[model samples]
Target: MPACEITIEKIDFEEPIHIVRITGALDAYSFPDFEIKVRDIFEKSGRNIILDFGKLDYISSAGLGALMGFAKIARQNNGDLIILKPTPKIGSIIDVLGLSKFIKVFWDEKTALNSFVSKAG
Candidate 1:
């Protein structure tokens, strides 16, 4: 089995942001659970989200699609989904796939969270 774990932590910024940290391989086998958890968070909290990719080592096409899907949902609900500190490998994949065009990517967590506030203000 591929090693993957998804954990969400709420960050208490002036405007709260949910940080979903994914670790290990996010491939076909693990993406479903990841998708579900993110959807649930958006449904329950309706807060903006920052996907922390600092610890994420790998991401398959399915994983990328799941993220795009969730970002779409977040946008429709007046929330945003930002990507934070993707590993170089994953960052390249995201760039090649044009995911960054849809979701902004930040090298720093504080910058990513602050982006949401700047947009609203």
Candidate 2:
């Protein structure tokens, strides 16, 4: 399988939210490709994003830093990056790195979507 597979879904609410589904491992090798895709999303004015890690098998420090970078850019645009359904191993790593405090993590899609709405209001 590919080092990483990324799929983006745009949901149009008051402010559009892009759901980016990633699979496989997001490490140093795959981070460049993923970063390229993310730049495309930013070009399209995709500010708010949901990172669906449900199928993600692994993530490296590079991937985690990219997440932080994405979140910062989104936040600058008055939006944010939210994590969805990360695997236990990924969750453990995120917690260990103290990333969860920086980014929001949710198990349910509805809740995650509503979080953006709630932030706007």
Candidate 3:
């Protein structure tokens, strides 16, 4: 199985948004790959990000910490990072740890995408 896989699809908005889908396990060993993928997006000045974690089966504290940092970066750039369709395990951790307050979680893709529009408008 892959340690971690990240696929980005760009959605054209007023400023464009990226839907980043994560699969496999996101642990210490795979954190660098994840960081690279996201850092590249920020480097291009793309801020709106939706992280689809439905296919991700495992995530360590390192992964969560990385996410927090990315969220901050996105927000600082007039955009934000949201979570989409996270599994129950991931959802529970986000809720219990109060990450949900910092990150919005949506089960529907349309709603998640629209949220960025609403924020921008």
TM-score of 3: 0.95
Q: TM-scores of all models? A: 0.91, 0.93, 0.95
Task: lDDT winner between 1 and 3, please give it.
Answer: 3
Off by over 4 Å in 3: none
Segments of candidate 2 deviating more than 4 angstroms: none
lDDT of candidate 1? 0.86
Per-residue CA lDDT of model 1 for 1-121, tens digit only, reads 4599989998776767899998888888888888788878877865699989998888888778878888888888888998999999989999999888998899998788789888878
Residue 8's lDDT within candidate 1 is: 90
Error of 2 at 94 (Å): 0.5
User: Which tens-of-lDDT digit does each residue in 48-110 have in candidate 2?
Assistant: 889999999988887898799888998898889999999999999999999988899999999
What are the RMSD figures for all models against the true structure? Answer: 1.5, 1.3, 1.1
Highest TM-score, which number?
3
Which stretches of model 1 miss by more than 4 angstroms? none
User: How many Å off is the CA of 97 in candidate 2?
Assistant: 0.8
Across residues 1-121, which tens digit of lDDT does each residue of candidate 3 receive?
Answer: 4678889999998989999999998988887888899999999989999999989998897688779989999989889999999999989998999888888899999999999888878
lDDT of each: 0.86, 0.90, 0.90
Query: Scored by Cα lDDT, where does model 3 land?
Result: 0.90
- The 10 consecutive residues of candidate 3 with the worst lDDT sum are 1-10
